[model samples]
Target: MARSGNVWSRAGVALFQLAEYLHEPGASVGYTLANWNISFGGSVAMGAHRSSLREPSMVAAGVLAVDIIDGNGNIRHIQRDESSDEWLADSCPSGITTCTV
Candidate 1:
């Protein structure tokens, strides 16, 4: 995680905690950003049995959508591979939707 010097720094910490909680065995998470009015949901799947003496692993999947915000905030929607600068400045229009990995 990146660190920022501001009062909203707590937001980053909270987000990290939320991620950790979702990674717990049999755990899941769903959240909405009230300020941005966008919703997100995802779950973690445990890969190894608990009784085995091997390190456990997890996989996660989720999607995020733009609510009323314009393509500016839509950077959140870009796939993990897409470049934010290219998409925000060149690809999508004002109010359309785009999905990222």
Candidate 2:
């Protein structure tokens, strides 16, 4: 849904505890997203997955629409595939920094 403009971040990963289970292994991911028709430049689509030889692996993708926030609490918008010296490294590639959803 990120690639299709229906998700928030372009890249994200789900995490679970390392506890032992007696049944077959599996993971569950779920979330709520807001709707917006706003358009902006560029997107960085990426994904990853894991599976056993007999199981199916899943694929995912997403995008970014807003540019950056200014020093005076203003938001700036930029063209697709375009970058400037003003963009902050922490914002452009918004990656998850935690081990849980």
Which candidate leads in TM-score? Answer: 2
Instruction: Summarize candidate 2's per-residue lDDT along 1-101 as a digit string, tens digits.
Output: 21211323222222221111111243222221211121111112112333334443322222234344555666566433336433323224333431110
Note the Cα lDDT for every prediction shown: 0.29, 0.28
Candidate 2: residue 33 Cα off by (Å): 16
Candidate 1 segments whose C-alpha is farther than 4 A from its true place: 1-13, 26-68, 71-76, 82-84, 87-101
46-94: candidate 1 lDDT, tens digit per residue: 1111222232222122222222324455423333234466343323332
lDDT score of residue 101 within candidate 1 = 33
Model 1 lDDT on a 0 to 1 scale: 0.29
What TM-score number comes out for model 1? 0.20
- lDDT of the structure predicted as candidate 2: 0.28
